[model samples]
Target: MKKILLVGAVLAASFGPTSVLAEEDALLVEARKVATSLPPKLIAALQDEIQKSGAEAAIPVCKDMAPKMAGEISQQTGWKVKRVSLKARNDARAIPDAWEKAALEDFDKRAAAGEPPAKLEKGEKIGNEYRFVKALPVQPLCLGCHGPIDQLSPGIKAALSQNYPNDRATGYSEGQIRGVISVRKSL
Candidate 1:
């Protein structure tokens, strides 16, 4: 009877943590799905706009349409979604909160240590919320506006200046982390 009771206690203790881990894992998976749903659509829209007009014309897709799309995703998924960066282009929108800042810093360190920027992501439960952030690696398509400021086309520079006078989101190379798609849901 004593041995059976001890075994039962151990099993219960182990299953307690296992269940919590499983719950967190499920939250992470759902958060990942919500976070990932926006980028491809934004990229496609930007590509279409760039092709229809020019890189200069595509600026509105990122500056304006991306936020609207994120809003829609938030409504659909019950997760608040936004993009953030260490070097924010639009200070009003892209500034990272304390938690996001820590994750972004960690992502940059990991990327610098040779981890693939695209694969750098963080997800966990914080208080009453589950939060996730997926690194947004700079792509070739992002180069026209996000590359070296000196290399930006005159038209692109003018548009950026007019739209975001204090933009700091430049000087990024392909594969570098440009920002993150951050999502959080209240639990």
Candidate 2:
């Protein structure tokens, strides 16, 4: 009876941590799904806009339409979604909160240490909320506006100046992390 009780206690103790880990794993999966669902759509929209008009014309797709798409995703998924960066383009919208700032800083360090920027992501539970952030690596297409200021086309520069006078999101090369798609949900 003593041996049987000890075995049972050990099993219970092991299962307790396993179950919590499983729960965290589940949250991470869901958060990843929610976090990844936006960028492709935004990219497609930007491509279409650029093709129809020009890179200068496509500025609104990122500046305006991306947030609207994120809003729609938030409504559909019950998770709040937004973009943030260490060097924000839209001063009003792209500033990272404390947690997001920490995650972005960590991502940059990891990327600098030779981790692929595309694979840099972090997800965990904080208080009653599950939060996730996925790095948005700068693509060749993003360089029209997000590349070095000296290299930007005159039209693109004018548009950015007119729209976001205080923009700081520039000087990024391909594969560099531009920002993160941050998502959170109350658990």
Candidate 3:
């Protein structure tokens, strides 16, 4: 009887946190699936636009499609999904709220500590909502517009100037953190 009780206690103790972790992991997985679908499609469209109409044309696709894509995904998934940055080009969407600011800083630290940017994510339950943030590293392709200001082509530079005059989103290197996909779902 003593051994049976001990074994039962051990099993319960072992499964407690694992059960919670597993549930949270499932939430992260679902959020990831929702986020992962949107960006590549937008990136593909941006790339094709750049290939045909030049890099200048791709900017509008990003500016316009990003929000539309977010809205569509939010509607379909019942999650409030958006992109944000520490240094924002679009002030409206890129501004991080209190929780998001903390998550972004944490992600930056984790990424600097040798974690893969693609694998870095933060998810938590706060009050009546669940929040998650996934890192979006600066890809080699992103450097065309997002890299150093001096490296930008004349046309691209002029377009950025006209479109986002107060842009603070330049001067990034490849593999660096650019922004995040933030999802908030109400419980």
- Which 10 consecutive residues of model 3 have the lowest summed lDDT? 20-29
Deviation from native of the Cα of residue 19 in model 3, angstroms: 5.5
lDDT of 1 by residue, 29-85 (tens): 999999999999999999999999989989989989999999999998899999999
Question: Backbone collision count in every prediction?
Answer: 0, 0, 0
- The digit string of per-residue lDDT tens for model 3 on 39-83 reads 799889988998999898799888998899999999999989999
Per-residue lDDT over 1-187 for candidate 2, one digit per residue giving the tens place of the 0 to 100 score: 9999999999998789888889999999999999899999999998899889999889889988999999999999999999999999998889999999999999999998989998999998988999999999999989999999999999999988988889999899998899999999999
TM per prediction: 0.93, 0.92, 0.87
Query: Cα deviation in Å at residue 68, candidate 3?
Result: 0.6
What's the CA error at residue 42 for candidate 3, in Å?
1.6
Per-model CA lDDT versus the true structure: 0.95, 0.93, 0.87
Lowest lDDT 10-mer window, candidate 1? 14-23
On lDDT, the candidate that comes out on top is 1
- Clash pairs (backbone) in predicted model 3: none
Error of 1 at 106 (Å): 1.0
What RMSD value applies to candidate 2? 2.0
